[model samples]
Target: MIAESLIQRKPPTKESAVLRDQLLRDLQGAASVSEPVARQLLERLTPHERWALLKYAGKGLRDWLLAAYRDAELSAAPGLEAAHYPELPEFLLDRLQDWEAKNRRRLEARIKNGHARAPETLRRMMVEPIALARFIADRGVDRWETMKMSDRIAFARTRPKFAQHKLKAFITFIEGGNPFQTRRGRPPKKAKKVIKEIRQIAVLTPDELKARLQDARQRLPADQYLIYWLVAKLGLTAKVAYGLTLDKITINAKGRVVIRPAEAWFAMPKSIAPTMEKLARNADAQWPYETPTDAAAIPVFAAVISERRVGPEIFRSETTLLRSSAIHAAMHYGQLDRKTLASISGVSLKTISDMEFLVPADIHSLVSHDLVAKRNRAILGSDDE
Candidate 1:
């Protein structure tokens, strides 16, 4: 059995005294000791004793103990440290590894310069490049330089929106001039509509939509819930919500929240005003807006949510919420005119148009009846005729 005594003993034995002295000496020494060794040392003490040791320890020893305990706790739970980088699989070629290392260094430099704040963001950005490298290697095309624009487009067509985003970031780090044409593979608006319609189905009522959001709020973290709430209430897209910065948001004199997404400023929902104010205050305290180093570049949602990779699953949910909200807005407010709906929801005109088909049959009939009546009146004919 491990000794229950701490560094400070009730009746100090010579061995106990020697151990304490050795620990202190190691802590004060310039050379670093491994956390596993430190954790082994700590396990001998009881929980209360460990707390007591930490309380009396000097700042250096205390910090080391805290780190050791934290590491131990995280190790006990897999994925607790979300930003921990995984080792490349043995199947990956050395050339691919070198390219990944180069990209990683570029990402590290970005972090050092404050261009990117989160390590998980870098991880997400690396996904497509790593996947592409593996794909090419499997096909015996190990070097990325040999890939053509058509090859890149073929790979891109198979990817979803999240991977596409990562692919864009990955291309920027390529050594030579951009190998593939950046704008060549973009699908037209009509093709997008076909895809959108295929994905969307019957619309939910406003109440039903609100209920779903409430359920999500309970299940999701606070930061994620806030983003979804903004999308639901303000009709903002999740991508837009994710990119919000403190500089773009301000609390007005009358205690209303105003957000400037583009050239125009829009008032946010009153229910969320207090939360926005609190977030603004917290952000202001952490990174003063007046700093010359682009403190305003820090995204409010991204900063909070970037500890773990927000992959395709989250984006898929966001898309569902956005489409549902669009339909809800149409049903709740009886909004017509594609442009007006587009302005309100921050979605494209095409999305608004597609959502119109999902509106209740009663609403569609009313619109059809109105149009028919207007046409008859123009011809100077009665409804009976």
Candidate 2:
């Protein structure tokens, strides 16, 4: 049997109770708390009370309180320790470990979800110079230390799965003291070969690309016309076209179709919007079918076909079948040698030059410079500003 303590326990002090209540209120209203107010509150708290507050409060809320205090110190003086919470060291280390474990689990889930390349990306990050790796690793440490948590919770929030893997890798390196060495000097500059290749793809155009869409439309469904329109006319990357909805397309009073592109609508990176608009115009001219009545309706692509209208089992498939088919049709019509067709169709020139397939000239002719430029500036980039 355990013996009772000889010393009697003391009741809570009125000051401590008031402090606790104020701390809770501060945490709850942290978003609106000014730095000066946060610093003043911190100044009033004893070290023990500060530690107790951090230990008891939610991690996110605690981090916000500390951050406000830190910001206050920065605005006043460089070395002011007004925001310093010594108790943070031990608490932060424990929290960092917890974050790392959570991140590892998320990475595993992503790998299971077909993000098989994620591990390779992590490995590449691990191989970077110590300074760069340490910088990223420090972000994870600081994020956890201040309770401003998350694997990618700093400047930009990463996808949960990716964030978990990246955070775990970062924490591991920090704990291990980063075995990778910093590079000795500036790395050699490699020739901008890919940049030139991209420019070539951008400028490439077929002398005449016609009849390719008509022939492909014969074999494909009417709804699939949008895919052809995107690939041939708008200069959209195939991935962007997959996310297109009827809402993004509008028919002006002039009878021409206008496509408003959005970043969320396309799964690709935001930088690709310019290229995508150029591709959209090319697609619009080649597409034979009229726009649908319902603006909210999503376009049906051959890749995502299923028995049910919407189901748990529906999955994305081919992104560029229409473009490939168009290329094949162009080759068959004896217009295969034209470099301009590759630019206009948004297919690589090498694909056309190497492949024996024929695409019609009529399809290529639809990609007018006037239309391409209009779509590029108006739909993809800023036309108004």
Candidate 3:
């Protein structure tokens, strides 16, 4: 159930009410019952309506819409108030707001100059500073200037190195001209070696890889299975697959399914070509009012089970596991080199290189080279030689 406080909030204005009604009517023009309403559907809904729709929607719609909402929120300005953290002192809150406001102005200046940046960027910049500020306040430290290097180090130890690095901007802001720098450098070579060892051990054998693919195909729904197939076979990341558009997928003259994400084109596996073709047809047919070639006019994968629109956020947890398993399988089989793996999977070459240790050093083919040559000779006839 939606919270009573949420449901009890002020009702929509007459103008917005009419807009919502019109939007609901326009949604009926979509070509298929399974297709989502236009992208504006969630944007048109009031916050209360959005909450109700999310709660009542099927898994597919909720997943898609939630991701949309999050993206929208991140791009919008964030509210700054002690209400967000009631325990923080007024002075601490002021300091935090001051820091946030300074960054906000810089972002606004960039926007004014035509370099558009989402407030999410500012939010990211402020998050660690606010967290560190709160940490200092909680320890009864009233002034940031009074804090020592030891205090900063104490906080750094609790966060990942990347997050800890974010404090540099805050330190510069606080110290005016002389920013405090941490003594820490890149993680030691020993730590890097340990991580590489872990990746090597995570490699999957051929039989185990086959079992995983078979199990997923048998158990997952058509829409989800398609996602898994894309990741496992073509090495496309789940996010890339999820955002695939009708314009990005096509059938080449050779009767093969081709997918273009960004500028790169990859042909789909023959085993799954027919399914992809059908999905493309369905998606195109679903948007009768618009041309399928129109960028993002039709999402390649969408809700199949219900009218309620879902978001990609639903599959957040599983994407990593699917991606990791695919990488491990590829490494073990040694079918694709580091450069090829990076190109197809959108994984960094650095990461692919680091995981190269997973490939077996002494992998041997089942058939000897001479036996393979003899079989080829038998097939082709000695006369050809």
The lDDT values for all models are 0.53, 0.41, 0.57
Clashing pairs in model 1, backbone N/Cα/C closer than 3 A: none
Per-residue CA lDDT of candidate 2, range 136-165, in tens?
A: 355654433343334334423323344445
Model 3 CA lDDT for position 291? 30
> Of models 1 and 2, which has the larger TM-score?
1
Q: 91 in model 1: Cα distance from truth in Å?
A: 15
lDDT of 2 at 132: 29
TM-score of each: 0.46, 0.27, 0.53
Ranking by lDDT: 3, 1, 2
lDDT of 3: 0.57
Q: Give candidate 2 regions above 4 Å deviation.
A: 1-212, 253-255, 262-385
Per-structure clash totals for the candidates: 0, 45, 12
lDDT of 2: 0.41
Which 10 successive residues of model 2 have the least lDDT summed?
76-85
RMSD of each: 15.8, 20.0, 11.8
